[model samples]
Structures are given as C-alpha cells and as structure tokens.
Target: MSQRKVTMQVIADTVGVSKYVVSKTLNNKLGVSEATRQKILFTAKQLGYSKDGPSEGPSLPLETEIENGYILVVLPNYEYQSISYTYWGAVFQGISLHIQSKKAGMIVITSEMDLSKKVDVPNLIGIITVGTVDEQTLLALSTYNLPIVTLDHEARIIRADSIFMDNLGGIERMTDHLIGLGHKQLLFVGNIHYSQSFYERWIGFRNSLEKADIPLTQGNQKILTIPYDDNMEANLQQHFEELRIHSTDFPTAFVCANDHIARRMIVLLEQNGLACPTDISVTGFDSLEEDKHLSPALTTVQVLKQVMGRRAVDRLVWRAKNRDYPSEKILIVGDITFNESIDAPKKR
Candidate 1:
C-alpha cells in the first residue's frame, strides 16, 4: 500500500501557527498554552500525521520504559596500569547484572576519549563512574541531569552518591596492629595525591601515631610524588634510597600505600640485603591474591570489593527510582589480615 503523505508543515499550516510552535505543541512541551496544545494535537491526529509513523501517532507518552534506556559507565583512564582490573571487574559485573535484570542497555565510555563531540543518545538514564573524575568530566556529566554513582574517588562537582572502602579506619587498624607488635619507629609510604582515599589514609596514619605518643617528625615519613610514567619504579627507588640514607634510624616497620607498592618495596629491600620482618617489617593495603604468594606473605587490609560493588549498584538503582532521596556517602570498612610479613621490631 502507498504510504499516506503527512508532514509537520501541513499540520502547522492547518493549526495557523509556525512549524516550530506546532512541533513544540505536538511534543507536549512547555511554553505552549493548553488550548494551543490541544488544538495542535487534535488537528495532527485528525490528519493522520505522526512523528514515528502514520500508523503510530505522536500521542505516545513522553515517559520511557525502564528496560528501554541506557546507562553509561565511565572509566577515568583507559590505561591498563592506571586501574586495577580485579576491582573494576567486580563493579562492572555488579552493574551489568543489575542492568540485565532490569532488561536495560549499557554504554561504556572512557574519559581518555573526547566524548563531547560524540552524539548523545536518547533515554540515557544514569551513569556509573569508576575511578577518578576531573572537574571537566564532572561538568559534562552534570549537563545530562542524570543520577551519578561513583566508586573509588569522590568528585566535588557531582553531589550524587559515592561508595568507597574505609581507607582511614582500615589504615588506622593496620597501624595499631604494628604498634601492638612493639614497633617503635614506623614509616608510612604514600603518594602525594589529595584524593579522598589518600587523604583519609594519611589522616589515619597520623592519628594512630599521635594516639601511641609516637613522634611524627619529617624524618619518619616519606611522601613520594612520583608521576605515573615508565620511570615510576626508578623514582620510587630514589626515594627509598634517600629514606635509607637521611633517616637517623631505619623504620622497623613500613606501612605502604597499597599491595602493589608494598610488593615492590619488599623486593627493593631484599635486593639491599634486608629480610622482611627479620630486619624490617612491612604491611600493605588491598590484600590482593598475588601478595599472598610472596615469600613472607604480605600483611594487608582486605577491602570488601564484592560488597562495595553490590552496594554501589543498590544505591544507583535506589536513587534512580526515588529522586527525593538524599545524597549518600558510604564507607565500607575492611578487615586487617595479619600475615608473616609483620613482626616485632628487631633489636638494633
């Protein structure tokens, strides 16, 4: 059958208004009078005109079905070394499972790419962000007016919900454990970022030192502000060497920023003829499985990765459903898993 010829201009001419006004009124948009809206819609339907097809008129509701929309998942850096796949894997798995259960679609994007030039998709419901988000990216997300849920790092631009591991409490507990083992000279190795996790961990380390009456002088702490590049290891080694030289007393125990750094530091120490726990005790955060196989078995804090993942999905879903819900900041506490790497300080 030949298709019926129905155009928006024909409808506008019949309604005695411009095409723009007819388009707005037919779309049920604001700024048009109630009488005008009714008149435009009635005339368009009577003329067998439709936005989708003649058989399907523009009378379709503006509301989208929950299963029809897409959720954008933005990862800050696409580089392999910058992100922990294991952690992000669990988070994406949780989000994917929830999206599948709701019969929704997912669009994964990375901040490394220029997304502003890309075309925007309709029915974009919300965003699940993993890793750090800069101010520029946050601004882009805000323009969408969609709910946002961040994991790992919290951004100031987005007031949406955030879920992260309790870095302060976990580090404090780890420090206390070392103190209980009779370690007097303790050292904290950390990056010089002001990220929420980094700042919290630094605060926890300082608090633990103060509570134990241990002096937190410049000599005992090392802040390595090494840029993330191929020379990261060399830069860290230089800092390690400086700490070994300048400090009057070698720290009997060292609390490292994370498991990966701790493992590298352990290797560096051994190369310098220092045995872990025997000569110097070591501890790390994020109890990764690879650390377990280390000669001495690294002592570290076990972040509840799976639980954090599940909680993030729950919060996003809840916020998407209830717009009136208040923004939430959730910190999931982790456990201190003791291992052979940590022991009483060796007598000088």
Candidate 2:
C-alpha cells in the first residue's frame, strides 16, 4: 500500500478555498487576504503538503520574512472601538510610538473584514489585539502558531499574553474616596457584565462597601447592571424618575463604571432636578480628557491606555523570542484624579 499524494487541490478542498488562492498563499504572494492565507497555510501543514516532493514530507512557510520585523495588530469591529476613539486612540498611539522607536512595522486590521480579499504583507513576528475580540477570531489566529498578546482583553478558551489596567484597585480607591466624603447612600452605574474590566470595577466598588458594612439594598443595585443600547440615556432617565417617585432616601452618589457613564449620570441627575455634587456626587473610571470640559470635571480613575499598548508590544516581542514560556497577564496600575464631581452628602 502507498500513501496518497498531498497537492494544492487537497489543501484547497480541505480549507474550502479555491486552488488559485492556495497557490498564491503557499507561494507567499499577493491575491489573498491575511485570513485566507493563514487558513491555507494551516491546512497545507495539516495535510502534509510538500513543495519539493512527497519524500520530504511537510514543509511550512519559509518564515524568512521574520527578519522583516513586522507586527500585526488586530481590533474588534465594534463602532465604539477604533483608532480614533479617545481611549483606544491613545493606546494605539503608544503602540505606534514604541514600534517606531524599535524600527519595526505594524499592520492593523479589524476582525470583520472580507477574509477572501487581498492584503499583502511580510511574514509577521506575532499578533497584538486591542479590546475584546471574539473567541472564534482568536481561535482562527492561533492557527498561525504566532505569539499573541491581547490588550484590554482576556479570552477564556485561548491561551495568550494579556495586558489590562488595574480595574479592581482603581474602582476600590474611588469608592473609598466617595465614602470618605460622607456619602453613605450610593448607587453603582454601568452594565456589570459588559466586559471583564467592568465586572471587576463593580466588584471593587462592592468590596469597599462591604468593608464599611454599607448594606446594598435592592434600589441601589437596580440600575447598576442595565446593558447599554440606543436608548440608554432615556432608559437611565426613566430609572432615575422611578427612584425619585418611590423613595425619599435616594442615593447620594453614583460610582459609574467609566467616564462616559459618569458624564451621562451627571446630566440625568440635573434633568431630574438634582444638582451634581451639591445634591449628589458621582465618580467614574477611565479619566478621559473629553470629560474635562464638563461643568464639574469628573472624579475618575486615570487609566494608562497608552502605557498598556506599549507594554503589550513589549510582551509580544518577549513571547516571540521565548516561545516556550508560559503566557502572562500584565496589569497596569491606574491613579485616581480627585476632581470636583464628588462632594459630601447634603443634610437631610
């Protein structure tokens, strides 16, 4: 008996791509997108395809372009996350600056591109992802066998180096600050399950309250976990109205998950005939610059977004050189910016 021959057709069929694509990809030429090229390469390797002959067995990409010194950066397709967004933009700027200093190339792409299209590039050293990427996308990336470092993301199913802010500690400090300012009746805003970071922030807030023996009543937890959508502002306003209608002991401060939600909370409080700080104080995380222009600057935690990007690049380079090392999670500590948004609870 003899073993079957492994050809481009076999790889193409296995990968569900056309033979032309397989040929272009195997030859390391243009005409195929990064995703398609990766798929074809993985399939060829799995099927034991050899360019020389069957006797030589499987042969993978030459990888000679590793000397090209290029790094691939992947971003999720969410509208709220991009290179231009305040937080993400700062992180990308850091990645860009560090890559330039190291004299390396960076290629950025979103997860929602047409996988069959053309995207020419040299063989990459590794991948660094920003924001929360879907598990399926991460699994697809793993096929390339390149080291991956994720910034502000943690995947349960895939093993990769991850870097994010000290979400838990940041929120805990903020909550302590509000409590010190004499705020007892407190509410936490933002969807707790929106992301791992958000959930950690909620936990930190709760931890501080528990230490002080501040009972978490049903009303305090009512609007904390509502998911954001097109009508988030309206929905938040409605919740506020309901709180006023039912209870005279309304919350005196709101610990928001992020700066955006904190700003929104301030506005909603004003519309509900409550003055921020004077009537109720609000605190937030991610001390974004856009919030500085607000009447009372948001009291929030300052996340090192750009520093997180630079650290992620450092981790990816380290992983590329030390492939066998265990994956590590790097946490960057954030500082609290004491601003005017928080004040002592008004006398009843």
Q: In candidate 2, where is summed lDDT lowest over 10 consecutive residues?
A: 58-67
CA displacement after TM-score superposition, residue 80 of candidate 2 (Å):
7.4
Tens digits of per-residue lDDT for model 2 on 48-153? Answer: 7888645345443332333448888887754424556998888888887888777788888887764344345656788888888888788877766788998888
In candidate 1, what residue range of length 10 has the lowest lDDT sum?
Answer: 56-65
lDDT of 1 by residue, 46-143 (tens): 67786656754334324445687888888765541232575566566676777777888878888777757643888877887877788788777777
* Candidate 1: Cα lDDT at 17: 89
Each prediction's Cα lDDT score? 0.76, 0.80
What is the model-wide C-alpha lDDT for candidate 1? 0.76
Off by over 4 Å in 2: 1-67, 78-83, 114-121, 217-223, 245-247
Model 1 pairs whose backbones collide: none
